[model samples]
Target: MEERLPGADRLPVGRRPSEGLRLPAPDRALSSRTGYTRGTWLAVADHLLDSLGPWFTPSGAQVRLPGRGSWSGADCDGLEGYARSFLLAAFRIAATEGDDRLVERYTRGLIAGAAGEWPRLTPCSQQMVEAAAIAVGLHESRAWLWDRLDGPDQQKVVDWLSGFVGSKTWDNNWRLFQVVGEQFLASVGAPYSQDDIDSGLDRIEDWYVGDGWYTDGDGQNFDHYIGWAMHLYPGLWTRMAGTAADERLTVYGDRLRRFLEDAVHLVGADGAPVHQGRSLCYRMAAAAPYWMGMLLDASPLTPGQTRRLCSGMLRHFVDHGVPDERGLLSLGWHHHFLPVTQSYSGPGSPYWASKGFLGLLLPAEHPVWTDREEALPIDEDDQVRAMPAPGFLLQGTRHDGIVRLLNHGSDHAAPGEGEPPADHHYDRLAYSSRTGPELTADRIDNHVALVGPDGTSQRGRIRRIAVDGRRAASWWKVGASRIEVASVVLGRVEVRCVLVDGPGGVTIRHGGYAIADQQRPEATTAGTWAQTVRTDRLTSVVVGLHGYDEAGVRLGLDTNAFGPHSATPYLVRREHPGGPVLLVSAVVLSGDTVWPEALAEAIEVEVDGLRCVIRMAGGPEEAEEVVMDGGGTPAAAGETS
Candidate 1:
């Protein structure tokens, strides 16, 4: 049954509730739908809040997740977590027209947190993160909670938050932490350093790479932080600034508007965002930009479309056990898969996903709730969008609703750096909405490696050459070897051709999707010609079109971080002596709705030295010719960078 927004259109925007006015209750039945309405989102928020009952202390200061992981190991982690999650609860209550029960519960905690009734956070820099969350929550609920606080209590809140005034923060997204807290302090007529706020905002401008994208910190670290933190705070800061908004506010709005165009495409038709980047634990936080855009009226999506995107993402996690049976979120992607966490992750980190509830602050009378839900970009049709700023080629297949990201840019390492530690998250050749980074020990899947003469493999830092339409090219070097690759994608099929000129006997290993061993993954091998692995729900296959020799395909148990087992279908070709050697192959991945078997009949390849012709099965019968340029003369073994 379709969810209808009852009486929401009749309500006025930003209607204030009288003393005893009751808010609309969330419909439980909506939770079961594959797609979501506003009520479904609220239901999830409420479910998250209720789960805290067992963990929440009587004073509302500490929420202890005894079984979960912790970072910082400070005594205040409990308090920090409670405050962060309470912020989400506060937004939901305020947005839902003041839910008395939830509001009272969260307001008590807010007052306690701001008043320092709980254990204080360690004086370390990491405290800035939790402080920012507290400030944002308080700012969002100002009318409902902050205004209700007595003068002394309000002063205490200021005094507590003042800890961030001159605190040192990391150069990356951490700058926004200070920016938001100080901005909130200024909004309340609290003493705040204009210089500090200006500095925080200024640094963000330096990180901007245009086309509405900002690398998280520096060195090609672009990830979801662009949405959750970078874009989110600026939009919220603008609202807090109001008519006092400066030129930067207009700039922020413009950037957000431009960003939504690409951000919306990052989400799969099934609601999963691109599973690339650190901190996969913050599941639905990806939806924050969608809500932030809607709140500022600065997004390209319609109000209905905004809700659809946010709701879809939230439902995606909820259905996948984001908040497990105990209603507690773990430090993992879907379930408690810990490999997805960064060093900074703690039990409460998942609460950051609460930022998605920023939409709850939007009144029901708003078009976002009243308008009929609209489909996302992928829901409409198959899409392939090239994001130059992040060096990502986003391809979404309408048939399976899976979005795949072909990475040529982001590596989390700085340029000019030789071979940095391989961060499986950013270093992977590709990321997908339906799959995760192969966080196993070797972390070799979805990457092309140059196996050294010493038997060790090295992956190079990628420099994006160009992104045109459905194709992208990149150049990178490992030791004395320089490699160039170009990718052309069609539906779930990607045709990648690599040219390498390295050491005398360097072999190239190109691995396809690291498909999880879900539902008893079985493999079918066609020797050196092609290889495939199929689970009941999905299929991953790689075929050698034009390569030197040899194919290496294997099922790797416990090789995936997301699932216990996975298999990587790969094609290995030994490099010919001295000159440039080219490896051409086709990789296909499809869900239950699409049969990858069709790609075998659809693909045709012809190779001529450095040039190759690729004709996708059902095309115009015309083959596209690709020329390869091998990096200058190969260096000897000891010629290191």
Candidate 2:
């Protein structure tokens, strides 16, 4: 390729040249041919770099000083990596522009940050926390961050990263990120202990559920982080670590091929991954696995699909309005979902968006670059995958181009189990319909979705539940797919779901609230909690929130009668074998704008033993079944920046 522009050789990073550098603004620009074209991803990288430049101080750490919006929580944690990423984008873009100053500046800043943090990273820093941050400081060779560092700064970063080998034993998501980040550093010959590397890999190996998925930590509710971080990071590690790690890396690479094959469907026509678990702050980085597809040559995904998938994500967020005014990235989608980020996510973190740069390492001639467009699984109208190893099935379906899940193999309640505590962010039923588990709900024991005693997410609790006198194991279903979980002590919960196919159409079903356990105490009516979703004449609703019950007198019984007083919608298990309160009373998806009279006419409720069937009024011959486990407005409320 012919090169142009004099300064493209290296980046000159003082501050971005021009502000508000908007490109032609991708407005439904479809390539007649491929996934991501030769320079499309590079353009994305450039756009991101240009868009985020304002967030970094010339010094390069992302404090977001006073006017920009005070940095807080995980939001602060994201700055380092994002600033570092400008170098990577600069590297890919520099070769074409012949101006490489951005590359040199970012690399220098990384070295400077390492030197600054060298004396401070305490023995007690969260293992994964520091590992993920400093690991980038180690490898990431594009703009030559290491080459620009003075000998001492280089040694400090290398030594600091190496010291992390035995610090904390990483498990689940932490281990997943640590291993992959370290592996990338190691792959590039950056300092990292072989023991730390092996131990991390060993831990991950234990959680690999066949059919291409890994459990976050060791619990239930593992979702997108696995696809984005777990499967993608190892390749970077093995590639950089030295050929000795190839065998293990290849094994991971192979399994990931299947996982990618299995997971590519999680993204719908709009490129949204069902948001499930924590640290959702990464947003669109969920598409990182496709980069792995380019890296590991994972099949069943063509260049067209890759390009479309990545671009679709870009469009989805941009359509939702990303890239805050100062050209900096901000949190929130539809405005209200902004808290989707964590304190760990400082301004620099959004650069994990560089995962989109997966194609950078691939030359212009590879098959990934040449392969023609093919429909991705998520692009399929209806798709299904069975996993015997995990003993569950994953199904993908689309309505209004929105993909959602219906989980049957999972159980939310256990025998004699009391309701979990209250949490500000945990939406109990969102997991049932999200493409992936939504994190960021302030968990307990670092688990993604579990609501612990303290009202924070806790480690997962999965075991067999006896239903109708027989023991039954369970799993997690984010959208149409199901992941077999560990055996749990559970009671009978028969959940049935029906898919309604129409623009903005939804399914509806009634919970068996008439059971003897649904008698509400007269005194608890005013304090109950409620979350509501508007679907048409039938507003999907939730109520009867019981925080904690102790003996006959409940310890925490909040009450409210605001939404759907007669039929509640929050709790999926409104009526159980032995409980005395029905939270989620009735669930039916009605029209938001245009209610198909058929939809209203097609709806009918039928009682069957402990199971209640919600049948559409449509002709019995053509009507479908609806599973109305209470809970409305599935909140995967996040988007990639």
What TM-score goes with each of the models? 0.89, 0.65
Alpha carbon lDDT of each predicted model: 0.73, 0.42
Candidate 1: regions farther than 4 A off? 1-35, 107-124, 415-418, 452-456, 529-534, 574-578, 592-601, 632-641
Residue-level lDDT tens digits of model 2 in 369-409: 55555566646554544433323334444433334322222
| Best candidate (score: TM-score) | 1
lDDT of 1 by residue, 324-433 (tens): 65777777876666667887777777888888788888887888877767767787788999999899998888878888999988888764555567677888878898
TM-score of 2: 0.65
How high a TM-score does candidate 1 get? 0.89
> Ten-residue segment with the worst summed lDDT in candidate 2?
485-494
